[model samples]
Target: MLAKVLEEPERGEFFARREDEAHSLVNLLQAILDYASLSPSLKRRFTSALIRLSSKSGRFPDCMVLEEVTRLGEDPVAAGSFGEVWKGSFYSEVIAMKVLKVYERSNVKELLKRFSAEIIIWRQLSHPNLIPFYGVYYLNASKTRICLISPWMQNGNVVQYLRREPDIERSYLMLDIARGLEYLHSGKPGIVHGDLKGENILITSSRRACLTDFGLASARDSELIMSSSTPNARVTGTLRWQAPELLNYEAENTRSTFASDVYSFGCVGYEIYSGEIPFHEVKSDYYVMQSVTRGARPPRPPLSLCQTRGLDDTLWAILQSCWLKDAAARPTAEYLVSRLRAMPRNAEEKTTPAAHGWDRLTRSRLSHSLVDHPLSCSAKVVQEWKQLSLFEDWEA
Candidate 1:
């Protein structure tokens, strides 16, 4: 029976068609193993073939598996286009597990490819400003659900952390973000963070901003952005933070260049300074796309807005230069960091909390009103409750 199963032309043909189909014959082989007491040599041959087939099948190595991980709760700490992030504990360490959403069998193959690609890229990156990746594993026995594990940022995403600790300096946050980008763009074949925005930036317990989510990242040499023929090259990042050239959809602009990242960095600056997303007033992403393609930008925050935030005019000027219609005119990430470093620090910033008194008052009132409420309170409020001394640590 084992010989017949192995010798079947149709079985061999099916397995040869795609590596993904190799597992289809596993059940048949298992049944044969139970019925026929195979000889040691035959068993060895079968084991060797199974090992070769496993490697070709794209299963992550055994080292990547988490023998046990305890989910904290049903609520996800964060959510994104690809998955929801839950806080979990593995080997006594708290980690964030991003569970990819389920898809039809037809699309599962492509999703798995993407998940594997993300892991490969993330594992190779090691930097202080880049979020640390732990590993990835299958969530269940069936192996249909995959989860990416990474260190949990206690402070959460940049925007959320900022809203909570309004006293933190915007320049410091911006500087951290710039440094992360500088690292990504400085390597031999620099990496392009295709999707960069406030949400993608996380704040570590040390109050440092770290970059994460490399699902769309690509090596400069690979030039995933350079080829317009590829669907991913054309549309992958958030429209609000995307460079005008990227929005133009021109064959040349379709290539994601470091210049495009600089443009998105500018939008991040706008978010940090104004406390609002780029084009927050705009009703639709389509409108923002149209406006950007025409050389229109999010209206500059008034000088008063900058002053109120304790931000120098030079920083605002840098943002303007970043949004220059010509991609070549935009300053490189390295230049932006240097310019930001040269800006003078505010005297009041040393003593004053970064947030205005009114903003503090408003938040305090909201917190008080929601103190007794459970479901009515937002995730941020719940987080605040959990970390009662969070503000004290920030002040320290």
Candidate 2:
């Protein structure tokens, strides 16, 4: 049956058959190893064959050879607990390669399993606001150095980009993130972005914001809580952006909900507006966690600062609602998107009439002054001043 399926020209059928064969082969090997001991030579040969077949089974069809990738830097573009991200060139296109760190030999199997899972999740997601996954590749025959590839964002992460262009409008950035979260939450079972922070939001070459780093993400129905006994399963999200409920022992059994994500979104909004990490003054993660659980909120940026950036009271109110103590009280990602969508229109409406009225009043006063101050100046000079005022008004 496998041979016949492989002979078929249809790509879908071929892949389906390959997947079935791979699973059957794995089960057979496990059974043979456990209940029937084979000669070491025979077992090794079988394992090697299985590995070779699996590599070409189209699981990650876009997987590239080591020769296809060229590293552009000695140092990684970003680094964290899981791995290092390096900028590289793949087929003439700049790509970000995330290389997972290999630890002890005993843990390699588990790490590879996790890496495969991440790949599967990325394949399932498709959104403009989410980072685009290109393919996966191994650096050596040992398969020890696995790298996940994606398009590299030239502008870097949100925090870095904002620092460089402090005057850039952030409403669109916040809206992009909210749209990504909404898409994740709207999936069949819904995906919770367990880690949502400014660092995870990348700025694209087109100046659009995209969400990345899904190492901690999980389906809402199967959310896992970090336990002391399972250090590997511990929550990897940053303390500052974590929801208060995530810090409570009693809530461990409770799955992370859409509300928790909303809480994190609020923190990200603060970071985007203030150009500072949430709880920037806090010295330690533990302290930040404690303060969050105790209901201590980050201080609001001064109204003058917010106003200067076109952020008004209505937007601030939305941010406040996001951090409400009761998760149920927090607005949904969809709702936030709608509010953000209407914000620019709201600003325009509020300012348009007032600005027009002020302009009209100024022109009326100037016209009256020109009439009353008749021959105090030469007629040619007055006519020139009148033409200049008209030109300025027209330009405005």
Computed on alpha carbons, the lDDT of every model, listed in order, comes to: 0.65, 0.64
Top-scoring candidate (lDDT): 1
* TM-score to native of every candidate shown: 0.70, 0.69
List candidate 1 stretches off by more than 4 Å.
Answer: 1-63, 222-233, 250-253, 346-396
Give me candidate 2's TM-score against the actual structure: 0.69
Residue-wise lDDT of candidate 1 within 81-102, one digit each (tens)?
8889999876556778999887
Candidate 2: misplaced stretches above 4 Å?
Answer: 1-67, 221-234, 345-396
State model 1's lDDT: 0.65
In model 1, state the lDDT of residue 110: 63
Clashing pairs in 1: 167-354, 225-255, 225-256, 226-255
> Which candidate number maximizes TM-score?
1
